[model samples]
Target: MPNGPTRYDTVLLGSPVWNVLRPPMIMSTFTEALDFRGKTVIPITTRAMSGLGTAERDYTASCPGATLAEGLAVRGEEVSKAEAEVQTWLKRIGLPPR
Candidate 1:
């Protein structure tokens, strides 16, 4: 939420999954600082072993009124090789690779 206008078309929310969930701090801080009424939220989570699990669900719940996109779950070990996958996901979401 950094001191700025409280509006955006899209938001990329990244975090590391802990115990099959997003850290509690993320949930509290983000929800408190930002309002997601009309934003498109794309959640990305990094995990060492567990997969996405409830990360997407948690993000959806956190951003109550936002449009939730298909979330991306990246394995910590594959992060180095995830460029293509990340690009694909970006394309699928109507965003060109940068």
Candidate 2:
């Protein structure tokens, strides 16, 4: 957490382009393992049809106090087409559209 006013109350946990392009590259960030104290830290990923994969379980175990939810697992190739769906999902989850 930073000292000043935070830009996000909901942290969209996502991997970089390189990670998305690679396979079997499941990894976590520093904040992924912290106790978020019930704050929303939504995980979003681009996968090859395998929905949610192991991320939900992994995140739940890592961030004990955070309200981890079922993440979006859109196919990598369909990302552009799925933008609106993703934005809607985010909004439904209380996050602002990008």
Candidate 3:
């Protein structure tokens, strides 16, 4: 966090889904302060059931001028089973989907 997102073209932001499928309030504090005008922001989440919840919309609001990529959500009990999804996401983000 000290280095911040200044050097990167993408950011992966995440938190446990809480309170009717929202990230904790503090995430906004972290996000709202930054300028992400040309950055790609990805939301990742570990949720019991909300599955990324309102994160896409939340990030859209908090991080201004950022391209919000499709995010990854792994259920709390299913982390071990989500590797393929994670890899696919990473690949898709890194390389054009074909």
Candidate 4:
């Protein structure tokens, strides 16, 4: 709330291959991007194999009120094979198919 310009109830973060230096900063900026007081912040990080690494830590610290949920680790090389999985995940997260 202190850093954000506006408040957001829920945040869904999906990233694959988080650049080494960019990931932390991205997470920090995201934290600063919105206020999460009394809101549920769902952080989902997509990775090739590392899954969710320090992203969880950074998000946790940035959004103290957030309920840091389990993340989904997607393999970068297998994106094509994971379309169905992606669709399922999108559906689970309330994103209707196009």
Tens digits of per-residue lDDT, candidate 2, 1-98, equal 54211454556667533433432344455554344656566777778756666666666665666777656877778888998888888778776688
Show the lowest summed lDDT stretch of 10 residues, model 4.
15-24
Q: Which candidate has the top score in TM-score?
A: 3
Off by over 4 Å in 1: 1-7
TM-score of 1: 0.82
Residue 85 displacement in candidate 3 (angstroms): 1.7
What TM-scores do the predictions have? 0.82, 0.69, 0.85, 0.63
Alpha-carbon RMSD to native, per candidate: 2.3, 4.3, 3.1, 3.8
Tens digit per residue, CA lDDT, model 4, 28-80:
87675666655555555556556666767776777767676555556667766
Error of 3 at 60 (Å): 0.5
Taking all chains together, the TM-score of candidate 3 against the true structure is 0.85
Candidate whose lDDT is highest = 3
Rank ordering of all candidates by TM-score, starting from the highest: 3, 1, 2, 4
Angstrom error at residue 48, model 3 = 1.3
By the TM-score metric, which is better: model 2 or model 4?
Answer: 2
Off by over 4 Å in 2: 1-8, 16-26, 29-33
Per-model tally of clashing residue pairs: 0, 0, 0, 0
In candidate 3, the residue pairs with backbone N, CA or C atoms under 3 Å apart (3 or more residues apart, or in different chains) clash, namely none
